[model samples]
Target: MAQGEPEAEILLNTIESQTLAVIDRLNRAILMLVTGQPTVSGYSAMVGTLRPSFDQIAQYAPRWGDLIPDAPHIRAELAYLLSQRGPLDRLQTPHLWAALGLDQESVRQIYQSRYGDLPSSERTRPTAAAAPKTEPPSLPWIDASLFQSLQNELQPIYLPSGKALFRQGDPGDSLYLISNGRVKVVVGEGETAKTVAEFGQNALVGEMSLLSGGNRSASVYAIRDSELFRLPKASFERLVEHHPRLMLEVAKVISTRLENATSGKPRADQALSLAVIPAGDGADLGAFCDQLVESLRTHFDCAHLSRAHLDSALGEGIVDAPLGTLRESRLISWLAVQSELYPCLVYSADPTLTEWTKRCIRQADRVLVVGEGRGTPDLNPIERALFEGDSFHPEIRKELVLLHQGGQAPQHTQRWLAHRQVADYHHLDPHNRAHFDRYARFLVGRPLGLVLSGGSVRGFAHIGVLRALREAGIPVDIIGGTSAGSLIGAQAAMGWDDVRMEQENKALFKNVRRLIDLTLPVTSFAAGKGFSSLLKQIFGDHLIEDLWIKYFCVSADLTAAQLRIHRTGLIRRYVRASSAIPAALPPVLDDGHLLVDGGLMNNLPVLPMVEIIKSGTVIAVDVSNPFYTADGAYNYGDPENGDSLPFGKVLRGRVLSRTLVTPSLVGILLRCLEIGTINMESVQIPKVDLYIRPPVDDIGSGDVSSMDKLIQLGYETAHQQLKGWKGRPPA
Candidate 1:
């Protein structure tokens, strides 16, 4: 017997005990079915609810397959019942029993044996449900030998009851697998501590931090005297080398806990990684590429490699080396030649690769197409190169947009880019090494606070911004939004893709135009419910709590004369309330006060984001296009009188009307120039690292077709903003 055999036996026994408890529940349910007056519908519902629990218990104890007779047939019966619709009485009971391979008499006898007796009157009827057929082996069974082998690789540590294994925010470098007793997972500290879950023997803990290589998100404390197998990162890595399945298991556990923690849907990162920056003809593409390489080298432990360098380094080792460091130099040279062996390799867009850029594009997870401000490079050759690749790279579907440098968008550039089905960026400065460095840090691994500024129909540009970020592989961990931005931010929090969002936005605007009952007059609040209904139809039953990322919507409370950041409520309602421009829609009522759009008072919404995300450096994306060169290009607001405003004359509804409505075009332009420019001085927040104000002017037409230009601008701006940001592979 192995050294850990006894402990493994104990673990198996505990799991068996839990399985038996589940069986007991099943037996009791059967007893009620035999004697109790349960309608066929009610009985079917009971079975439906209980079936999953049986499967869950079975997963924990695979041996249940042997112990539980007729389990397979029972599972089949349950499945069949679940698949059927409408009245249950329409089916033949005997045919169901035969198909389920169940004997009613046997079930009643077993139920009667366990619960003393069944009602005499009920026994005369068809004997309820029977025991399930023997289940087939399903769960991945960890035998004594496997357990002992794993134990030999890890150090066993014992802790007294009430002792902590690890605390929230503590640096973690080890995985803890419980050998005995239990542990409680807690979040927060001191009086604010809250228990999230408790796990017993054989359960894994601390894997989240171990996999992420970050501080613990929560704390684990021993609920009782416990024994744990502590596997150091080194040992776990070795184990994964030999048993790859173990890694998948660990990922599953971590994913489950994360889903529960954030109330987000289960999601995995995309495999295809490529960012294409079109450095125009005038732009120095090589210098820009070198800067990106340097920033990545400074931040991540990575080095650049070209085909020539790789061949030369492999064939002829470095000749110039210090006496003592000859071996170190040779090793680095060898590794450079063998870059494919490393877990991560970030390369530059070598001009040489341009000859095979199309083939390279197929192989790469991400590709950055650098072009001039005028338009994209001749894509015909690149597209032709893609056809030469034997096998398509999994991430080939990743972004392939044109990144422009300097100047306003060229007239022909839009047509050219749209023809290639690619987006364009004109806001990035290739010379800004400092911004690239920060962007590199963001790309490698940095939490971001995404602040979305309200811009009504103009907000469609934000989709391009999100697409660029997604392509670059930068994830926004926290979000704040105002008015139309709140709608975009909510979608981000829900993990909606950029393409889907763009399509939905186009559909929404079309619906808005058609649904507005102009016959009823604009001042009568006729469009409010229809608009709200549209939002509901699109968002469905999603709540603010359903947001995968921490998020808040900004709105102004008219009665309180205050800006409010709402964190929890119906997501559609929150968006509607935040977008309630005085005369445009009805004011949303909350806590006896009416609230309208936050843009009038807080158009930028930086403070609300700063308030929620206190610790990390905040990177904000300010989308509000408050500046316009010409009066015709400017978007203006109307008068906000109670009679004219659809939100009503309650509390301080007219507060913004009195304070914010500036009639002078010169004054509005000046204020826009003052507030619209994004800089540290303007924001006044010490923690803010980067605040981006994309080049977008107001569009008064609100034309749906005009959105393509805004989206293109957004794409170009976001792509430029993420100049040094790069995507990372799944951990």
Candidate 2:
């Protein structure tokens, strides 16, 4: 019954007729329409049909709904189809938002707000034009009604190529949504634009930084002529309550872009939202807390009620505002106050509330389990079921993984699950026991991957371990189980879903994932919380496309260039299909040696990481990993004569392995054998995805200087052993 639904269904049918590659292009074209800058763009007849375009997109990504913008010709067609003609024309003017109806007077006043109080003459840095008109919404969460309201409220502006829209770290004053032209986002501490993401009409920007009052995560500049709408914070918040669905939809689009541009690692803005919020008990807490109690209330009921009921309920003495508006505002204000007082964070979940809890475990100094394995009326209906039991095995039970589970791990877990199979390795093979201890050694130099799961909170001892890890530069990714603070590492890594972080936070997560996938080596992770069920519910048949593998860049450890160098050796060969490993890249090293391997993974030219063993004096060497095959398939390179194949050279029959290698230990061993500085010198580590930061469990005896507690823990001894590794290549 909404304004666009009937028309939307018709559009979807048309998109279904397109070829697969065309679908992706169509998706981009539609996005360009919504995000394009209006004021400076020259509209073409070919670009004006909203209806036909919507119908085309509807054909393919139907459930994607009308939030998906229409391509030029299709948008024009849709305008005529909806009997809403003038608005869909490709124009750089006020007609776009004006056709829907938003506040003009409030808008213009905001334009000259003098963000830096520049002189009136100095303020002329290419002003934004009048925006489309939009009035206040008549109903909450209804897309069409909100659209109508926003139609009455904006001043449009067009940006030309090379135009500086805003700078990174700039103060936030207003939010802009593209209407006509394309703009590119440049990130990385204002150094240079490394990864460029383009946004056209309907794409939103500036909201996340504005709302959080944080410095801009990435700078924005125009590429082509652009039409835009400026939405200040107050108006944005007002629109959020009245039209929650619209706000959420806008966010999803932005998030998708950032994720695509940076691989999986989000921009700095997103990184914060995903990180764990600290947890600590207030010493002066408890007793009568009125303000703290008020926030948990909601006004969803008030918004849906009839005017008559509201009039009777509040009477004439109340302020003359919309009944729904007043009630929602009251609830929001109360909730905000409570959040401030409690100093606790909360988040809404999709299938189950796990992301929030995951964060709590990561940051909490201590946790107290206060439940009795069940819930009563005292807790919310959903709360009891989520928190009343253990859903996962403990983070560390010493050694009881396979025993508790019904069956042995399939072939997948073989190499990954080898050690720690017994409570004590005393009776195990000497080599295997040493292998277990190698984990500790690997952890000493590199950061560790600390994951958390389940419902109940762990004791302070666990928190202490996490702190130690953090101090050692370990990057923890907590996968939250249902209940309490469920926001965990992956969510933090990806940011929240389309509906969660609004637009800004979503963009942050998307960027994080982009960088993560592109930079790190990706290995498959076992699904948790029945991810298959969640994937099916949301993405339908194409779960592989929807469930993405993202890469995250750790800022503290490495520079972007170093990371790019490492990633260049990887990415190009990825087979993009669901079965994993691209067809273009065959296996290069099933033999498992780092130094000599048969076959290159991809034919692309790359600098492979050469291995260095302690041979007294062997200069650092660089090897190439170009998936070349001279005989093409049969690689009989023979490193002795340097006869190689186009695919790769098979130097040896098998690699000698000490087994159980950690990333950090390898880094140190490689460095020491190459005669690189082993002493402490400030060095930054470049980031890559899927590689877990090793935890510091022991210290080497040779480490000198002001040894910290970790160093005293004997983590360094093993670290030295790993650095001075005198083993043959893995065999």
Candidate 3:
């Protein structure tokens, strides 16, 4: 060997041995933090051990920067840990544990196991003191004292299973309050009888009869052994006199039940009959049916009876006669029997088979028109005639389901929709089993709502997110937004694809001067005319109600001091109102109300989407300012020569430096607005099925120069986060 080769090898081995020892210490420290009891002394020892190991690891960060790129992040986490006041403080801080690569939920559970739930002061953080110290308003129906009073005037009765509480047409003398078990409310009798509603604990039953002073509307029977408190008619009248709100609450329930019965929509507990019909030739109708049936079987007792299945049944004498030979009444009876046999019945129909298709359509609660997304969107003459003819029921919900292969974006969907009266549309990948499962959940009436948060220029990131979602085949059935989100969401609702949106955003933001209309700063810095003109150029007098997708935007109403959701109005006007930043742009006057930027209140607007869908998959994209620690905000300084910090820290430092060095009135107002919005997002984001926070913390809300970068960041973030997003069904 060459001279000094043996000595060099000995030196390298010595260094490797020292490094492995440091790693071993670091692993033990992390394990102790994760698995050890969260005692102050134990955690303190862990922190003490972790500090020197982290410092030792950080010394090698520069040499392995490219190989172990998360070095800077680890350093920041270590910095955060060392900055904590005490072990108790560190244990209480969930974010610290999360930053240190510990499971946040497990940390919370461990902390709570020792300390119970976090107090209100800890839960609200900085805003805890701002919360009003008053008892929350209570409703009469939920008041414990009111319930106790009512119970004092009534006697409890035990109900045995299969026993009738009261028969239909019985005189309305009393109302029963169910304290335990379950009961079914039925109408008619024997084979004609139907259980229209069911009640369990805390439910008020037979209130309709008592309130109307008439015979019972339905027979109440105990399906399970139960206990009920009986309030006589005289007592109920006296109670209503003392508590007027109770009558109103009961009336509200009755009104809701009456409306539901008259609406012709099935109850939540009822079975669903769906018919899948191919719209055009070459559509994989059989395969789609099989996949759908398989997907539905995951969450439902599903039965698939295609034309072939029916033929087999008829040949086996399971069906008495051929469907063609059966009378209309008999066919209806058979369809009803199938619906009763399964929680979900899927009828796969061939468009060419006019009689068979008609039968399926007639029996269906909903009809799914399946088409190849890339193929011609035209419907066959037979299909069109069957759908439009007198035989087709107008009440049957018709929705378009476009199947794609190889991750193709939906094309010519509007054309396909025009062929028939479709309530909504969906894009599906035939080869993706997960896609089929998602579609099945949608069929069960759990839709997907996409919420885009507002961050002015940062909103451009939403375009990239939309691009990634389309590419990943994530469906967005309803969309809601605020401020900048409204501008982007309007385009999306207007059917602007990701590419088109990207092109439009680039063209619009290329020259920022076009968006400015400088005026005297009495009300705002700009007159808002420029922004209005820009919106007009894109929307051209279209109504919000006329958007291709179901959409809404939120705006802060200054007159009412409340948030307004604009689902119907002139599109440009409402969007302009929603985007009007207070002190920067003038408030918009619409429908006799002055509206300002919705970011002043709800920047994410997820709650409105939740209210609209009632039950659905909600995916929220937050492009708001990135969160920073107090230490990161104040202690951040320039790194030494040849030393590099994490990209996040660098971005945060830049933003903080600019704000702290030379703060302006507009900047202060905007910062406050951002803080409030961030707090609100924390609450709303958890309610959604998926929450996407793009890596654009360094990009300021007003920074329009790096629109391309922001978009790319959003695209990458969404693609990474949605890798395992198989949306949940409605609760």
Candidate 4:
């Protein structure tokens, strides 16, 4: 491409490779700066493969010179070349950019010559990196050949149609690789068994044990004695140590599995009941319609006796089939739903419908009433009246759900009685605002109050909210920023004050509580008392012994730290024997470092659940540390949920006139309004306002747990100095 193109590429490649040499630590600092991996090699390989915009930025803003006359890190030669804005201000020392052999001027020139000047907003800060256009999973190497070299290490097993391979509680250090055959993973506490997942050949049973080095997280049993190639702990460890690329493939699979296991079934919005007791003199014609509503709600909500599972409807029994059961019913119904864009109803001719019709309307998709075929035009009198008014649609197409409101049962209701079909119902509505509203009633807050923002247009509605909150001196946590957030950049921008930061420290810790609860398998059958207790165990006095002497950094995988320059990165924490966690009344500092630095030390725990649901709470939603997505989804390794580590939430409080209406301001203003009550309790920080409250973690397991098991599990037993425990004699 150019005379020096290969040299430039090679230089970039070497930096990428060296940077990956410290992947575990690098993840903490440079997660979003580079894309595609938490693994060093994985990230380096991607660097060689994809030319990220950062590279362009680097070329455009290359360092000024090799040596600095004054403020070496900010040298004139380097500043003259690289400093479009002037000076390398980030490094603690001057001339450090030169020391790193980076020329900011060259990077700036490269960017200008090729991509041109970046947006004014983007050019202001070196840290203001452009987000990768690719989805995180689709970034690369998720399903790539990174793992192809280790194909032989993966053994396959096949099982007969009905046989048991491993019974529950059978001790095994190896994880099975499924080649073929059906298998079931059943989990429960004595007698009450729930199959977490059904596996076919090529599935895994005890991979979690191999991943975390603990006993099987869940007891696995073969529904049918299936044949599988099992990866022994030794083989798996060797692969991970030598062939780190292979670890990335497993990370993708495991992260996805973890998300799936926790989310159980795709959630649906609750259906509103349209109940009419009937006109007194005219008789209760709407009674049948009311019954119809009840029946439909049960079907849509997927209600049942034991479990609310949606698929339970298809038991061999007698009951009405669900609505609109047909081959192309969904397509037909979608036509009507599409026509009803302005929020009016539609009716059909025959009244009979198909499964697709119900699906289409429920999902906010377009619907079409096909009543013209059966002389039962799908219009209700109310809908007809509305159509006649200002909002009428054309006489041909319309959006209608209840085609047969004429006191009659639709034909499709029999499918539930006739056949039990738990459809996958392929779609991405789970992230839609309309779809999320379906689960509104069940959510913590009723009449859900959302400070929605972010979009190419409508940026100010939320900004107004932030400005007012700033004015009121209120501590506010935020979530997704869009149409509204665009205007209210102040709250996000100005959330750096001290008093605000002080009050928010506890609030942030409380959020840290939620992060841990959400991330950990506290709901697992293996976990006896929920996630809070499990976190306590990890961060507790019962932690691996002698964690007393040094700082412990958090990484997705602890062992990956071996790739670090020093032997220091692997320690989970320096737990002094019998030392208590910093449970000070408030504003507690850590390792002599004030964890909350007014603006620094922000451990933003990105909220996956909230992003999926699209809420607007910083902690309740998702957040990156100091860096976060424009829409506010978090991206990174798991530092927020690290063992008992607290986080800080920074809030913005600025005053704004009512006349200055922006989406961001609107978000802040709306927070003060009493929209409704929320049933949700924050999972972080345990609602702790008092200093006496025990840390949400547990510290009493060392004396009670078997020493042999602890050693075998690779967890050194912390001293049994917990206030309530007496060392029990080991059996």
Against the true structure, whose TM-score is highest? 3
TM-score (C-alpha, index-matched) for candidate 1: 0.35
- TM-score order, best first, reads 3, 1, 2, 4
- For candidate 3, report its TM-score: 0.47
Question: Which digits, one per residue and each the tens of the lDDT, describe model 4 over residues 1-731?
Answer: 53334433333333333222212122211221122122243333232234333332232222212111222222222323334433344442223344433345654464455535523323444554333222122234333222332333544344543345665665667776543234566676567977665554234467666667665545554433334566667776786787575566666666665664564232221212111111111122223233332333422331111111112422222112343332122222222222211111212111222332222223221122212112333334333332343322122113222222332322332221122121111111212332223222222112111222221112211233333333433333222222112112222422233234323322433433333222233322122123234234333422121111111111111123110111121111211100111111012123343221111111111222232232222211111111112533422224566722122221111232222212232232222121111112233212211101111112121121222221222111111111222321111
- Show model 4 residue runs off by greater than 4 Å: 1-149, 160-162, 176-184, 188-190, 194-204, 212-214, 221-230, 248-680, 684-731
For each candidate, what TM-score against the reference? 0.35, 0.24, 0.47, 0.22
Order the candidates by lDDT, highest first — what do you get? 3, 1, 4, 2
- Per-candidate alpha-carbon RMSD to the true structure: 26.4, 25.5, 29.7, 32.2
Cα misplacement distance, residue 469 of candidate 2 (Å):
43
Instruction: Give the C-alpha lDDT of model 3.
Output: 0.65
lDDT digits (tens) for residues 707-731 of candidate 1? 8788888889878866854333221
Model 1 poorest 10 in a row by lDDT: 264-273
TM-score of 2: 0.24
lDDT of 2 by residue, 386-428 (tens): 2343432122112111110122111221221232221211111
